[model samples]
Target: MAGFVNVRRDVDDKFYRYRMPILLTKIEGKGNGIKTVVPNMADVARALSRPPTYPTKFFGSELGAQTSVDEKNDRYIVNGAHDATRLRELLDAFIDKFVLCGSCKNPETDLILTKNEMIVRDCKACGERTNVDMRHRLSTYIIKNPPPKKGKKSKGGHAEAPSPPNKINGENGDPDGEENGAGSDDELTRRIKAEAAELNADTALAKEDWSADTSPEAVERRARALQSGIASLAVSNNGGDDDSDEDADSPYSQLGRWLQENPGSSAIDVFKKVQELGIEKKHKAVQVLAQGVFTEDVVAEIPKYVAIFAKMVTSEKHQKALLGGIERLAGLDYPDLVPSIPKILMQFYQADVLEEEVVKTWGTHVSKKYVDKETSKRVRKASEPFLKVTEHFRCTGNRAN
Candidate 1:
């Protein structure tokens, strides 16, 4: 029989049993003999005794048994039935070592073997999900391969020689020699000189344009454009016709002529004329007055208009325009106007309807202007009551801070 044999012998009055097999019976469905017979040892032994020949193999191993090391390597190589069993354990170890959450960089994640035929990992920190199969392949490659070590320097104060660059494209010179060069040094120097000359010409032209003179005719035309609507007014009879005509025809010429013709006229007279203009015409008059104020020609008259805007203004549109004018005045760095800021802020506070965004906007403006620590603290504290009132009315989106 192509099977096993048993030999019984006595040595020194002690009997010994030796069992051997030539062929084993293959199980019905399982491929190999011993594995098909029975999985457990006692059942395998029972199956072996009842078979035509006693099978010496265990779990399909020709040596009758497999060592733990051989089985592990075989499991790695086969990669089908036995390998599937060990894959999860290997994946768990890889995830613990390498994988991190994409959002929070946390490694605390759970592996969920999804039914959609994919391995997915869920991050506990930031609730991000990642593909485990991709991460696994990347992790395995990283684990198997390591980075190259840097070379150590040579002794005797000499550094290790750098590796020669590889030649490409059939270059004639050494591969590293001027590989990045685009042109010769003489070509670059010529290009730089040409660019510098172009820039110098442009700068000289700009200076000449800026220094060009504004003729008296251009000044007269600008004044006539400003006085287009007021040209029909009857000339005042209190002055010489030539000078009065000049004053009546041009606003700016009138101001200049007044300064020269009636040097004794007080600033209050000029201010009174400005205030007498209709409200619709006041903006242009105010702009002209602002120009005069900026030039220190009519600075004494500015305080009257400032007082008028502060007290006489009731309409919100006019108040806003007045505030803009005050902001312009503040930009002039006039020390005399500094004390009026707190009064202006108080007026804005009284006039505004305590709307949340409005209060916050004004509050921010106040904070920017009031640099004194105590004054800033007081202004911020004063704003809190209004902010709270706005919140009580369900205006929560406005942020004052």
Candidate 2:
């Protein structure tokens, strides 16, 4: 009776520890009004570190039905008859899309709303913040009803000082636990009357309740709150207003996007663009350019950017950056690029771009910047052909010396 199962589909292997409560389905009603209910959705969502509404909304989206959550009662229902298996399958999709970070594939992440309202995932496991795909239907719902922000951890692991006290209570003349005379007493009376009027609305009481202010400032405050919430929702449903804003903001990213878009563009053109952008001529920056520019078809297109690579590896300082960037550009599951890497290094050698020692050391342990540790190891494993070529050159050169 472990009562928990791993979130991932590792049924064949029972050693997984990332566990969550097994989905429980409770079918209710009948005919057209029938629905599937999940009693433990709140618990399951807590295990996933997400709001219950997110998975509930996802169920609605996946099943092509309406969904509702009675938060006070912890009841989640979908307007269809869904079995535990189907719900679990849909839950996996939600976890993959929202919970898991695209870079590290870990669930320890915080979904952040940027100033411009774009949703990005900040990976706790990896210090990387990447943009969330704005195309999902649940993106809007998540934004509108974002889960409460987790507080900073203190040494004792408790939440950062509890959230501010209620505004009504704090507005007293003696907020620091002491009482004031008529001013404090009058404010308390108004606050209480306002709460009662809100709960039991009567036209007579609403008019009498002085705390339910109809002033311009109060109206403006409410309007602004509504607008801010609407803006957040709009951002969730729609993508960024300007896609090129990031490009314009960062020259490094600008060059990357430009290079990726125009593969046939010349090295002279790239160098000129780099100069125009006021980018530093540091080899490290060039390595960044190499990473940003060439993302796909790099094996075939590597030859075209020979001049760019040549400039990048001109000095000893650029050697490590260029090699590390190369590892990242074609690190894993790219068999075609493995052999080409040796030939590419040879071409760089013939052009005097990379010194023989640098090429020899290229066989050393892989760079872990681009890919994860395990993937970096596999990438180096795939680079055996290139390593052998470099070793042959080293032996031949030694014989000549």
What are the lDDT figures for the candidates, one per model?
Answer: 0.31, 0.55
Q: Pick the candidate with the highest lDDT.
A: 2
Question: Model 2: per-residue lDDT, tens digit, 75-178?
Answer: 89987677888899989898888888889777777777554444688898997888775545576444433445677642222222321222111111222212
lDDT of 1 by residue, 212-283 (tens): 123666444434432431232222333212233236445534543343333323344554443333221222
User: How many residue pairs clash (N, CA or C atoms closer than 3 angstroms) in each of the candidate models, in the order given?
Assistant: 4, 0
Collision count of model 2: 0
In model 1, how large is the Cα lDDT of residue 38? 21
Model 2 steric clash pairs: none
Error of 2 at 109 (Å): 1.3
**Candidate 2's C-alpha lDDT?**
0.55
Say what the RMSD of model 2 is. Answer: 28.8
